[model samples]
Target: MKKFIMCFVGAMLVLSLAACTPTPVKQSESATEPMVEASTGGASDKVPDPNVEPMEIISVYSSNEDATGLNQAMDAVDELTAQSLVDKLIEYGVLEEGTEVLEFDTKDGIGTLDLSKVPSSGTSGELLMLTAIGNTFTENFELDKLKLLVDGKNYSSGHIEHGDNDYLEYNRDYKKL
Candidate 1:
């Protein structure tokens, strides 16, 4: 009798273990295959009749964030403005007696200001060069001010032809102090 009971218990345990095991689904019998595709930025027909236009990207040379209601500050950096500014400075006699700036291309947060033509006998002009430029531009145009960069980076205060000392600096928190 003990032998019979031991055999019955062993069979029951095996059956229970088999029932607990999970069976894998046959791939051939499955109804659908998995599918995945990369998604892009595009509007679906879900929102019909949306008044939207294509996106336009442009480089901003200057903006007039502080000059609200004034559109002059948002002027795009262009050749005309650059040439005018250079001419104005020369006319203003800020370049000393013999200083001659060959080019003034300030765009995309970068500038290539060349002043190698300063006359041999003219007074050295570096201190007021950048300040005069900043003042002249800000005064005439309604812009949100500009930051000067050399070859697309912040310029250091070096000597001429280096585009040094032409950056714009501003303070964000001034009221508390």
Candidate 2:
């Protein structure tokens, strides 16, 4: 019957869409079990080994800056990692020593930063921290935007709330607070 045929076609279409959806990367329960996603593009997705390089220098952004608002520390990319950058920030007094990078991934020019925690600093401090993160990742990875997530969800703190689709842009002019 004509009705049966239409129903079959609609079912097929729904099945096709579901099939085309990309599988999400599963979150690991512990640091020992590292979560891995398949890379669709170049080597940028994989962080280089710290031991194997004619070290590449990367600009590690910091909240510490003078009038021009461009504050950065040059660091050798022994391992290109979100945590490494965070470590640099801590060294520069941007973030606390205990903070950890929960997850970091980049695809199609969008980088995601899932953090174990976001500092309870006030609005200005929060903005500066985000600026440091966004600029550091975008510049180093050649990404267009950076998404900040706390514990696998959109970043929400007493200071700021990012929407589901919200992202941070690379900004170089953030002044010291």
Candidate 3:
């Protein structure tokens, strides 16, 4: 009787742990917002839009790697980076008092921007806006370059933003627009 009771208790404990484990993105709701979990760091998890999911640039046909490194890199990202971009634009006086950020970088290199999220229309130079975002991203992800696309098109501009800067120089407007 004691052995049977012990067996039941162990089974119950095992079941409880299984319950605590996070399930895969299989539910209908999760299908719309596929969560990206950071393997180690407790960073921001990106939820791709159900309307348009972002595509990944993998290692390719020959090497055949998922580029999980890139995915892992993004794990440290959070929504705050997107918010900070908006704030910086406002401080530079390029964005008006309440312009919203469409989208921008995750801790991983993937930038998730919602230009419609900008509180109001932007009031800044396109170049200024471009560099603010490009430079901000390149500063962190030194491995791959960022490709800015607005409404599914390349963020029309030139100048490949580069890292390798000695100073931690990002624009400081200090406003949360």
**Best-fitting candidate, measured by TM-score?**
2
Model 3 segments beyond 4 Å from truth? Answer: 1-80, 104-112, 117-125, 140-143, 151-153, 156-177
lDDT of 2: 0.81
1 versus 3: better TM-score goes to: 3
Question: Which candidate number maximizes lDDT?
Answer: 2
Over 1-177, each residue of candidate 3 has an lDDT whose tens digit, in order, gives 999999999999999999999987555654766666557533444555798644432111010132111111122222335455445445544345665655454445344444532222233334344444444554543423455544444443343332333122233331211
lDDT, residue 92, candidate 2? 72
Better of 2 and 3 by lDDT: 2
TM-score of each: 0.29, 0.63, 0.30
| Preferred candidate (TM-score higher): 1 or 2 | 2
Candidate 2: C-alpha RMSD to true structure equals: 20.3
**lDDT of each prediction vs. the true structure?**
0.44, 0.81, 0.42
Inter-residue clash pairs, candidate 2 = 50-78
Which 10-residue window of candidate 3 scores lowest in summed lDDT?
Answer: 59-68
Clashing pairs in 1: 63-144, 64-144, 72-142, 73-142, 73-143, 98-119
Query: What tens digits encode model 1's per-residue C-alpha lDDT throughout 89-141?
Result: 55555444444445455455444555534322212234334444554454444
> Ranking under lDDT, best-scoring first?
2, 1, 3
lDDT of 2 by residue, 44-117 (tens): 87787788658668888776544234477788867777888777777777778887999889999999989887
